[model samples]
Target: MSLPPPPGTTASGGVPLSRRSLAPDLSRGVMLLVIAIVHAHIFQEMVGGDPQAPGAAFDAATTVFVMTFAEGRGYPMFAALFGYGLARIHLRRVAEGQPWPRVRSLVRRRGRWLVLIGVLHTVLLFFGDIIAVYGLIALMFAGLLHVGDRRLLAHGFTWMALGTLVYAFLNTLPSFTDPAAGGGVLTGSPLADMVTRLFTWPVMTPMLLMTSVFPFAVGVWAARRRVMEEPGLHLGLLRRSAFAGIPVAVLGGLPYGLASAGLWETAGAAETALAWLHLLTGYAGGFGYAALIALLAVRLGDRRGPVVRALAATGQRSMTCYLLQSVGWSVLFAPYALGLASDLSELGSVLVGAAVWLATVVIADVMRRTGARGPAERLLRWGTYREPRSGSATVTAQARSGG
Candidate 1:
């Protein structure tokens, strides 16, 4: 329903395709790759694989690489993008002369739909679904859209500090006591597993929201300035972000990464400190990744290659591709399905994840070439932009205003 707006005009009267920025879409496409790799090992860990267990040299390297670059990295980027998209939608509605109440209603309706869809996704596929959590964030923070820059940035940084502490404590608690103590994976019938997933979703959503608030708030701040939407205008900021954020992220992640990979063992207070460092810098890394991609988009302004096109397409249909990945995980790792989770090594699972991502890229490219909107996007737009009833107050107001 909301495909990249057609060349000159959008049926929805939103931004035109020609006017759309490349950075957000390209970053989303690339972000999914990181997500896939991260989830692959998580799913493997869910079943039987010990991701941090010392193994072959290559596997050790894979664990370190994933811990450093992929894990705790992808989701912040996603949350930021989510915030950016929400701001764009709100801005568009307001610019079209819609009143704040009307726009707020529209956004909240979409958030509710996202929560519903996310619940279904969790029950049907992965237990670690973030969709519903993001929906909740959207609902709670929609009012913050009108806040000043200083307020927005302050909120973001405050949450970052608090969330870092919370996450660090939770992450390192096991290290302090029984690091090996954990629950076993659920290997039940499909219906039973679905029930288990349903139970897990509610608890997971709030925890995720706590960790993601900073990224989401920062994204909103960036969108207010059109940072990603106009990369060239903010080249200096982008360069600084890329140069500083990424290195800090990489360096901060190393101690935890190595320890998790069994290459370096640290416990108690030291491990807790590393966890704090890792998560705090992960936000930086996420921001850096987005800036780097924006810079790349600037460089390839009009000379888009097939790979670039494909990646952009994937980003445009990111929700659809993300759901599709859940399906892949269901097939590949679910105990009731192939049950490959127990069989594959961490490195091996990552390779499989890479393959899954490539497959989605090809699929997304095909959808783009066919001039098709993503199914999930279509559904969301259909729900969010529904027509008012003939006799409704909104319709009456519009008719009176000659809209």
Candidate 2:
């Protein structure tokens, strides 16, 4: 597989190098879209009416399916891609003769922006904002970037293990201290929960930060090694990573899922051990997810097929689409809004998510036709360049210089 030029670099005598505007971005967008569906369902399940007093089995079942497929997997994909994008940016800067130190400043700026976005998302939109965590994790990327690939991979696994141990130990604590402390579905006023999550849930922020950093670090390692850019060199490693990741994900996910639903009641030493095991497995699974997806993107990207193109479009504008989902769902489901939150089942929510994804596709398609970038992308470009709007000629020239 051929590696595309660094994000902002030109090819040869600069006939306006293709922006590697291909599959990965689109695939990531689809992942985010699916994630929104799960988020919507979860919000409803928690706050929509009482599940115990439910008059809706269908809704409940839909919720189960989403929980099964999306909860464990979706964010990992996003995290991995975040890493990949970070590496790409780093490479582009290096190609432009910028020192790597600039990455620190960029990460800091981006992290601050991410934290702001995440805070707003939690307060006004969704409480499970990953951006804030991502922002925090971005700080570590600069340090991690300097590490050799072997060390980076080793450190990634070490953190995964340590994080799991910490998580599992905490999980088993209540079992020892107060076994009767029932795990209730997290619900209540969004405002109340938001406050609690921010202030009381000590694990929330750290977990978010870990989720973002682990995958991102891996992405940096992979990019430095040119793994995605030249897949053939790493196919063996990729395959092994996938093989190891799948079973680990299953083992980790099973107990965690059961624990979520109140299946495990006892808090023995064994349970503590298993809890740590689950945590490690989950992180491994996330890495596996990243490797598998990156491999797929590299292998299939060159074809530029229709599906690939569509996915690429979606990925390119993921930030816009992600925010759009939040806005759309809020209008559709909020108690003060459309109030569909109480109306749809989990399964129905998934369908609604599909509908939302389709809507984004349509919008993306329309924008592409008009030679338009997503609004968020456009704004980011403006911020990056500190420039006014320009015609395609100017864009082509910019492209020639590797923007």
The models' CA-based lDDT, in order, is 0.80, 0.60
TM-score of 2: 0.76
Task: Flag clash pairs in model 1.
Answer: none
TM-score of each model, paired residue for residue: 0.89, 0.76
Best-matching candidate per lDDT:
1
Candidate 1 Cα errors over 4 Å, as ranges: 1-13, 16-19, 50-55, 175-185, 388-403
The count of backbone overlaps in candidate 1 is 0
Off by over 4 Å in 2: 1-8, 11-18, 21-23, 50-68, 167-203, 262-279, 290-301, 384-402
Model 1 alpha-carbon miss at residue 137, Å = 0.6
Per-residue alpha-carbon lDDT of candidate 2 for residues 300-380, written as tens digits (9 for 90 to 100): 746766666666677777777777787777677666567676666556666777788778876776666676678765644
